[model samples]
Target: MMEDTIAAYSGGTLPGAIGICRISGPQAFALADDLFFPTKGGKMSQGPFYTMRYGQVRAGDGRALDLCLACCYPGPSSYTGEDLLEIFCHGSQAVVACILERAMELGARPAQAGEFTKRAFLAGKLDLTGVEAVADLIESQSAAAAKNAASLLQGGISRPIRQMREKIFQQLTHFYAVCDYPDEDLDPFVNEEARKVLEECTAELDKLYQGFQRGRVLKEGLPVTILGRPNVGKSSLLNSLAGYERAIVTDEAGTTRDVVTESVRCGDTVLRLSDTAGLRETSSQAEKMGIDKARESARESRLVLCVFDGSSPLTEEDRQVMETAQGLERAAILNKWDKGALDFPEMEQAFPKVFRLSAKTGEGVSELCQWLAGMTQGEGETLVTSARQAALLGKAAESCRMAAQSAAMGFTADAFLADGEEAVRLLDEVLGDAVSEDIVHGIFSRFCVGK
Candidate 1:
């Protein structure tokens, strides 16, 4: 590690006794050579890349600091497709600062957020999907999200895009060969062939377009907001579903004065459950704000979980909340099932799909999860798996539509060709043909410096 090496973490264990520094890029090895001194055989520069060696980090005067295990990763196969150096030194604020300051003095600019992985993308080792997966993997809140990210990183998204691109390329080549050179006109782009090709492309594009919603849900997790009057067992239901004390259950109303957000795996999907404050008019500022946040959360949520006490009658506020949640995918959660039937037969009949459960007794949570899974079935099967990708897919689909329309209407072939070219351009945007530096920087800027 040269002077540019940055100590990523100052605390990996207690007593501040271990620090990890990752130095990446062309100068990584050179930077490591500047700080690391071998005791006997040689320095860090003498070792073959990818090998770990025992070494000591030293100051300019050569005063002893901490012994460390340093590893070098040469370019093309390394994490960032550049020379990389990993330094494991004693986790001490002073020691880490010493290493980092030495690195800066030697010439290593601190890696920006996501810079290492961004470099990996720029180096052609990871595509756009893989880059997004790296972000998702680092930020995963549930097992489902983590698994999805891992799959994407392993080229789950790239495979289909590549396949689609290949098929389109073949068709384009066949069309051009026939049109430009009549000698090969045996396989002409007649109406039937054109229609067939167009249909196939349309179907595939539609599938990919429809997949965006599901992909977003899976990646971000369904935001399920629980809305109801206070003391309706919303907290208890949250704790029950999560199998832990995720929310504080209280018999008193207005107990949850603010929204509490938590995530849990509901089968293969990640469910980001929000236990909101009871929805009711209140003069108190905090309570009012809480209710407002609850409404906002409910409005934005993928699923509205409306909770009601089984023993109580429907209140005006409950009806209003239900009306607002109309048209949204909702599940009326009937809590306190052990208490007896709720007074409103109409409410029960109105939401025939209501899920009855006892939050205190841990009953019906599985059934609820099942219903949730069923409702979300087939949603993410074809989702684009990344917000960035979804946008591009959508834009590409629009371009394809324009091209297909132009081709169908006998409009200028230039317009048709332009649309096709636009479609290809958008596809290339996602498949790694060309992207802006500002976008790249903006994306990697989210990463921790040492990444």
Candidate 2:
């Protein structure tokens, strides 16, 4: 690799105090030396490998800049296979800017956003799926999501994809052998044997396919709306899940006139619960908009919680509300259990997945958690949660389908072979064995600079 790439990355952005200002390439150590001007103990930068040198930072001038730490990483086994230099500086914006400015002055260029990780991938230190996992780990909101991302980052996702691609390519070669040399002699085409191999490949891939649905939900949580008439304990439910009063709770009806969203973990799944205003025919202009938003959230949810005041008798208002939530994966909540039920008895029959509990008292919340957990069990292990990966895999599946059909059609071996080779190439695309520059740019562009 040319040092010009380093020249191209003249000066990079700093993300703040916690982030390291890294300069990786052939001149990493030299760049560090040029940028560093210590104001403290003498000869600290001359330490052994894996040692941190504590000192004051400096600008182009010999003047002290900020107190900083410089850590060195060398060669082939490093995260980015290039010689890497990490300057740990005071997280202040001014300190970061001065160090970066000085580095560029000394011929050390700034690293691009995710450039280190990209370099790692290019150097064969990581696979495509592993690269995606780094992004996921950064974006993960919940513990479970972080764990899933970590698993993928550790190559839990890529190992399987690699294995599957290898098997499919091997089968592809065999398929081509059959297609190219028919009964005339070079190779014998055994339909049963070939079908068995093809079927097994498809079967294993399909198992991974089945996991995508659950994985998609985990990666992007299922939108579950918590809705009901005003004063039906919607805010109470929100507070309980958020573990604090995120939404204002009041005895007054219509206190919450807009949708309030909070995300919580139910076992391994992240549930985005939207607590919305009570649905009703309101004359007030503001209330009407709130009601509209509430309805919209409910309609968009993968699941809905229709709450009713179990302590109060069922009214026509409740019936109207329940009717609106039909045809969804729904659970009915009989809130205010502490107050005791009145003459209203239609809740159990109206919505079958009825939960008799009090959000205020925190009863029966366990059952709700268990149900939501079951909804997304075994989803984290899937490889296709990423939309980009799924789209590519789907394309590979279509190419496979084309090859299968061409094989069955009794087409000339040359034509059939073209289809088979194309299918293999598409599979390579899915595995990222061959990637377009557009894809590389699209994925890495989303990353923040100085990654």
Candidate 3:
């Protein structure tokens, strides 16, 4: 339990309708009673738990600061499993500052970033995964992302991990039992059953690992970089997708001399589109630098949109663009389709996924949008969105595979038991059972103050 009481402004900043100030610790109710005078003429310290009271917050000089509502939650039933007080006051910078300063003067220190949630974790109210889900839920950008985070907060990921850990623990215990009682004949099917359990656990971990790719895309928008030679309508396509003038479009070659990035929602998916400088040999120092950046962006992006001019014959610059996109997750765009079609047999053969569209007229753009949206559609599958969880799951899966392989190879029970124990340890870390202090601190640091 925390010895010090902490308070912070949990609501939005000034110039809003209301401000919420929260105090959590053993001294929460006492501080509330000292600072707030209830309209019903009863002390807040003596108020019923989980009940709200109309009150006027006052300063140390007995001057009324503002009319507000105060709610008290007693220890072990509150958000942090400690006594908590919430004040809903008028949204004004001066009012909020005064109340917060008054709280500090009343022995309630300011809450650190994610301190409330950290307290919840320490008090056994929530696990590591649940804490992560709370953060994810706050930062979710799309509907799908919010839905998945909500599912995770409900123990969608933790329940399966706990089950797998129990299975591994059972195997370890059985193996130890067989070794301890050599004279007693154990079931002949024990080894086979253990192997099956390990294999199934490994398969489940692998499935979760595979979901990370789609989950990551849903959580953080899919990175898409547009690459092409000069005057290939890359910027125009970017503008069309963004539904505004995000990039300067012109008839002149090399109009875009730098990377222009924008994010737009396409159905449930968010596409982080980067319109890069035209890829070509340039003498201008700035253009050359931009081309370098374009290549770097292409290398780092998940999807490359290589645009080609359909109104003209394919030049060496176009062929060079195709070469850059080779061996990458990419799609070819035949821009200027309204003008005329070009005979590019080689370009057609190289890119399996090609779309013919005029960025100016917005023709056939819907098909491309549909494809981008389809990439992240999961049909309500529970996914491991956190990198930490995915990495731990990978480690656990590898351990399971090693144990299963050892059992198949007829190795000593000690060797496979060590692998099983390691798997259990990794899974425990995933569920916050055996996590390090540094990892917990790092995870909570991502949260805003008063969360």
What tens-digit string does per-residue lDDT give for candidate 2 at 1-451?
Answer: 4262242222234444443677778776766666664445444235454667776667776788877677767766666787776777666667767777777787766667778778877888877788888888787766666777888888775676667666656656665665556764223354333344445555655665666666677777878998888898988988877678889999988888889898888877788989988877779899999988988898999988998898987767677778878877788888898899664456666665777777897887778778878887663464566777766666655555555555555445455456556656655665567889888878788776655
lDDT of 3: 0.91
Q: Best lDDT goes to which candidate?
A: 3
TM-score of each: 0.84, 0.84, 0.95
Error of 1 at 101 (Å): 2.5
For candidate 1, the per-residue lDDT at 155 reads: 78
Tens digits of per-residue lDDT, candidate 3, 1-451, equal 8999999998876779999999999899889888999998988888776887898999999999999899998878888989899999999989999999999999999999999999999998889999999998998889999999999999999999999999989988987886788675445477778788999999999999889888888888999999999999999999999999999999999899888999988898999999999989989999999999999999999999999998898889988999999989999999999998776677668997889899989998888998988988897878889999999999999999999877766676787898999999999999898999999999999988988
Kindly give the stretch of ten consecutive residues in candidate 1 with the minimal lDDT sum. 1-10
| Better-scoring candidate (lDDT), 2 or 3 | 3
- For residue 359, model 1's alpha carbon misses the true position, in angstroms, by 2.4
Candidate 2 residue-wise lDDT at 135: 82
Alpha carbon lDDT at 188, candidate 1: 29
Q: How many backbone clashes does candidate 3 have?
A: 0
Clashes of 2: 1
Q: What lDDT would each prediction earn against the true structure?
A: 0.73, 0.71, 0.91
TM-score of 3: 0.95
Pitting candidate 1 against candidate 3, the one with the higher TM-score is 3
